[model samples]
Target: MIGDSNRKMQQIPPLKSIQAFEQVARFGNVAKAAEQLNLTPSAVSHQIANLEALIGRALFVREARGMSLTPAGEQYQREISGILQSLALATERAGSAVGFDCLRLHAAPSFGLLWLLPRLDHFRSCHPEIQINLSCSYETLHFGRHQIDVDIRHGYPDWPSLEVRTIRHERATVLASPSLLERIPVSQPSDLLGQNLILSEAALVQWPQWFAQQGVALPQAPFALGFDRSYMSLEAARHGFGFALESSLLSQDYVKRGDLVPVFPAELSTPVSAHHLVFPRGHAEMSRVRHFLEWVQGQLGHVFNY
Candidate 1:
């Protein structure tokens, strides 16, 4: 019994030493393993020496050409490789099951606030088991860092190494506070010449574009107040600060509440922009990602026309 206990103690290598030895064995070169594991070659060699001492055997036979594993070392390497591979596989499977591994979603801040937030409850209701992390930025994502799984972009479809799906077409119209419209008489697009304009930096060109489509010359009297986000710009319009060109889908809630009113009738509409769902190329087959894309499409479809 005492002999068996002593032997068991000798068989266990120090944790760090075991890890270093595993890297060396897997890479089949001490220098390469050191680089891969972010350790010095000397440190790797020291760990291997300690591991050899613990096992009471020469694991590798040093030669003029390169080091080679001994008969015993080959056997140990096979066993250790299987154990490590199993551990890695188990961790990956567990992470996928819990959905806590990582799933990154990138979206424009205004759109996320206006459209996505309202419908997120339905997604959470359906995918209660999955954990979702969101990244809100105005700029495009760098997928090289593996930081994003999906991106919702507003523009013409052009992204490298991505599968694009058009979610909705952008249709914008002038909206103003009910109080502002009540105080001032506004019966046509030309009536906006007297009112203040709240311009969003993102859509600074939208009003001009829409006006050109209507064949109405740009107004030159009242200056426009500019804001960074559409939601804030809309808020300014809602507070009677100024009139803003807002997407119908985003302003639907306020319009329904009678807080804001559309400036022009539907017949005077023009093509503004388009929203798209972008995913990494070749990863479109992922089940969870597909589920999210489909859910967004269904929700946005119900809210926006096309």
Candidate 2:
């Protein structure tokens, strides 16, 4: 059994190409990397090319003064850097083989609690060493004071210095429990007006907005119940109290799990985009933040403009 296991073990790889790739990523210049490694610029470039070929992905965006890492290259560089660091410290810095990275992520309460919290384990499964410090609230993040690595914000993207990417390309629709639907049917858009409509003070798109899309006029009366957060509204709706107008992206699990259902056909739904990934220019360069963002990009089904 021991002999078989040893025979199945993969052969040791050539570390020269990996080193060359890391050096180029570090300096963003073949000449500078070659200078440090005591090799010609051509040799450094050749080694990186071999590494890229072996991995089957371009690692750099070649430019005039230097080369910049591509998105894939950035992630690869981060992983390779950690491994190389571990190898270097193996003999000298015992028990400190792998590097630990921490990501401080802040997000809207509903998204954090209902959506991200459930899926986070998948990220942990892939990157067990990456530590995540997550905070959820409706208030805007104070980047400097909070020391947030990145944030997920809902509503319009209007920060002055921060960059924004729309994380959810989704629809705004009326959702209700089967029991609630049985009590008050919603065959048309105006039918929701008669039912107990849930109100969320923190919602990016409200009942009025959703009704307006269907050319239905909403009344000035109060809702059956109101809440300060979207999660509460969704939970109330899921319990059959009333219908809720929410993002298809945020309410996906509820609908899938049979806790809630879309009241209208998809044709009646309105295209609404609210959730966004927000970060400073320099923060995107950090390995931990970049890694999280990349993983987030993979979580959503539709991730472009709505």
Candidate 3:
């Protein structure tokens, strides 16, 4: 009975020691494993030493080249790796079975309202099983704090520490209410000079940029009403308050309904503001992430022409 008890005790490793050694062995560097495991290099080294002592064997040979696993260590490493992989797979399967495959989506408020919200039903139809939690705000999101699975942003596509995919391009155009258009006949871009201009604080330079693109000198400080958000500016324009520079994509529904009219027959177009889909760099291998990205790419169709 004592012999059996001793054998059982020998078969089981000190779990903390074994875990540290496995990480170090798999990475082939104590420092690298320590970083990944959120432990110090010294701590990892100490754990490895304790493991070697418990097993009554030296697992690694420290050399000028680097640490190398001994033959016995290599054998033990293979077994440990198999065990870890099995545990990971089992955990993943259990999580999935419990409907824990959730995706945290972050998006800018105006873009979410005008563009993404309209098309999100399609994504829902495609990924009915994947729960998506969307956090919409006007400010830039901190991906680490929000634990965001994906971020949809409208900008230059140069976000740090993220994998970026250009989902769509954007163009800007002047939109005015049909009532305002009826009152003042605007046949060309220059005709906008006499109209009350509505401006979005977020896109203050949009009109100036559009005028520059058309090679038309903007009237110095035209009478304008300014709002903090694009959606509010668009709302003001819809109510016949004034003309506003709006995304061709977002203005299409109103334009088609004759609620809004474009200032010029030839719409002022710009190099598409790259609407990007971003995610954490290291999560590219996750199956759910891969699937969602593929779906997003497939759904990207040019919904506007100006």
Error at 90, model 1, angstroms: 11
For candidate 2, write residues 1-306 as lDDT tens digits: 988887556333357787787678767889888987789999988888887876778999999989998998877754543454344423333544467566778999888988899999999998888888899987885453356767888888875445677865577778899998888866888776667889877777788877787798986778999998778888999999988888887898999999999989999877777888886555677777777877877887554442
Candidate 3 residues 1-306, lDDT tens each?
999999988867776677787677656788887887789999989988988887888999887656788987876764554344334544655867675576677887777787677777887788787777788875665443346667777666664335677655556778889888888887777887757988776762477777777788887876579887777888899999998887776666677788888776544555465467776554546666676777766655543111
Q: Which tens-of-lDDT digit does each residue in 1-306 have in candidate 1?
A: 999999888787776786776677655788987887688999999999998887889998877656778888877764554343334434655767554534467888887788787777788788876667787777886443335667877767765335677655557778888788778877877777657888777763476777787777888764568877888888889999988887776777788888899877887665565567776554455566777877876776653232
| Candidate 2, superposed: residue stretches over 4 Å from native | 1-98, 303-306
Rate residue 94 of model 1 by lDDT.
Answer: 79
How do the candidates rank by TM-score, highest first?
2, 1, 3
Which of the two candidates, 2 or 3, achieves a greater lDDT against the reference? 2
Query: Distance (Å) between predicted and true CA of 163, model 2?
Result: 1.6
Pairs with steric clashes in candidate 2 = none
Score candidate 1 by TM-score against the native: 0.65
Best by TM-score: 2
Per-residue lDDT, model 1, residue 234, is 88
